[model samples]
Target: MVKDLVCTLKSARKREICCSRTTRAIIIDEPTPGLKSIFHIIILDQRSGKAEVQYQHDYVGISTCIGFNANPVINFSGVFGTNAFALGTDVAFDTASGNLAKYNAGLSFSTADLIAFLTLNDKFDTLIASYYHTVSPLTSIVVGAELTHSFSTNENTLTIGTQHALDPLTVVKARVNNFGKASALIQHEWRPKSLFTISAEVDTRAIEKSAKVGLALALKS
Candidate 1:
């Protein structure tokens, strides 16, 4: 399910802004069988600060894999919106430790999903840079790439190829236009179906003025 709404920030230091947060809850339907169901609750919130539940159901029947004759696995991926965003800053924090980012000396924390705030100039304008790609709902894969935009038009097809990996569509994130000036190109790498990433050198202020780099939440039943 996809829905959009407007949210006014009490302390918005930026104008062109984007942010996202994804949450999940899960439960096991049965645990003693060759195959059983695993239930999941998924939430997707967008730049507007509005959230929607996309799936509320059991994933494919589960089967244990081991000498014990059974194994369990859980999977979910949700993709929405643009990643090449403008930022006042993407206030990064170590959710596990509850420490907020200072945006200096490099943000050394990393995770599976994140929503970032970007800014250009001193206009208090924040660009929301998001990142996501499509893969099978339950299977895991390792994708890698370092490529370029390579083409353009009123509409452009963003592309990347693995420097060593063996997949063509290794990374996925659309080229997002910030303030009608330039597009921020983001590269991606997905591993084992649980980790999603985008990495590049970027100037939050120059996101709308020029090109830069940087770094999803998803669910399914």
Candidate 2:
């Protein structure tokens, strides 16, 4: 699993100080076979806002994250096993409101050549499934779909997309949903770390509508 944390601090006064500190400890070191756990604590103080504390824990097959400033929120996520088939769930609880704010679960199967995943998100109101396959050493494909149900509107929407790699440095992707909107993009790496991309979107139901086009370039130093 990969986790990213970002902190932003803004202050109008030049004399204000913004700082952060992180502490980590191994709480359990192989208490039993194949079992270990650690704790991480992060403290951030911004000049313009209150101090915030974040906690994270990781075990052999489980992980947890928690953050609180005034309203505390706790999150727990865990993967069951260390095999090709994996199951995981992410749940968030709001301590101030005494309710579960978010919950999501997923099951995935992976192999050397293929990966498949099915997930329930948005408090179980949304369902998503995806498949990825490596056709050859230099070519691969991916397909994914998302279905969402609105409780208030009593409506449903589905979107599906696929991506294909033409070569080591070029790729094309397209997606369309139950709606009339269709979009496609092609990206190519012109240099070792530079990329150019062209994308277009059109409403298929409205043949006379003008298509939207976009271009992007990225470079790395």
Task: Give the best candidate by lDDT.
Answer: 2
Candidate 2 residue-wise lDDT at 118? 82
lDDT (Cα, tens digit) per residue for candidate 1, span 1-221: 45443332322222211232243323333344433333322343233332322322222222111111122122222222223321122223333445542221111112343222222211222222222332332332223222122122232322332222234335333332332332322333443444444544333466555555544422232
- The alpha-carbon lDDT assigned to residue 125 of candidate 2 equals 73
TM-score of each: 0.17, 0.68
- Model 2 agreement with the true structure over 1-221: per-residue lDDT tens digits: 32433353333311212233433233444445655444334443443333223322232355555554577677777676455787888888998999999999999888887778888888987776766666554566776666666665667777788888898899999998788788999999999899999999998988577589999999997
In candidate 2, how many Å is residue 9 off? Answer: 34
| CA lDDT, every model vs. true structure | 0.30, 0.69
What lDDT would candidate 2 get against the real structure?
A: 0.69
- Candidate RMSDs in Å, in order, are 22.2, 9.8
Candidate 2 TM-score, C-alpha based? 0.68
Stretches off by above 4 angstroms in model 2 are 1-22, 27-71, 141-158
Candidate 2 lDDT trough over 10 residues, lowest sum: 11-20
